[model samples]
Target: MKDLLIKNGDLVFTGTDFRLVKGSEQLRQNVESILKTSEGEYVLDEDLGLNRENILGKGFDEELARTDIVEAIGQEQRIEEVSQIDFEKNGRELKINLKMIEMDEEELELEVDLDA
Candidate 1:
């Protein structure tokens, strides 16, 4: 799969010049999107995102939060299985280490961040 490269929510190239993201880079982008998007935010796919309602402010349980995120990733067809997950929380910021297998049997390690 290939997609236009996006950085900071904007296309990385101007008119007539396009940067494409392919292979592992594209997969990484998909993973990032899954983590960054809150459930119900995208009108087309209301059930296709993560539920981050309990990740911010008070009543934050690391285990529950990680479970939610893991389940969200599991819902994606491209991911075959999640082998490992490591979460590091600092205030409203979170760092996640993920090891997963793709549908094609490729194993990948990804790092994702969330800021509440």
Candidate 2:
């Protein structure tokens, strides 16, 4: 599958040409989407996002955040297993390290940041 490339939540293009994402790039895009979207944000796909209910309150729960990430990503059929997840919080910033195996048996590692 090919899609218009997106970076930092914006479309990426070169001059008059639009950049495209494919293969592993597409998988990375999918993973980003899964992490960035909050539950109930997409009207048609209500269950198609990460649940941030626990992270929204005053106190941050690392366990809840990890569980939410695992559960949300597990919903994607392309992801076979979430092997490892590490969370680090500093002030309002949250960093996540994720290791997973795709349905094709390919290993993937991703690091993401979120504002808490």
Q: Provide the overall lDDT of each model, using Cα atoms, as 2-decimal numbers.
A: 0.83, 0.84
What clash count goes with each model?
A: 0, 0
Q: Which residue pairs show collisions in model 1?
A: none
lDDT of 2 by residue, 1-116 (tens): 79889998999999989999997778778887888889889999999888988766577787887789989897678889989988787777878888989889999888877777
TM-score of 1: 0.87
lDDT (10s digit) by residue, model 1, range 1-116? 89888776778876689889999888878887888888889999998778997677668777888788888897667888888888788887888889999989999898988886
lDDT of 2 at 49: 88
Worst 10 residues of 2 by lDDT: 53-62
Candidate 1 lDDT at 51 equals 92
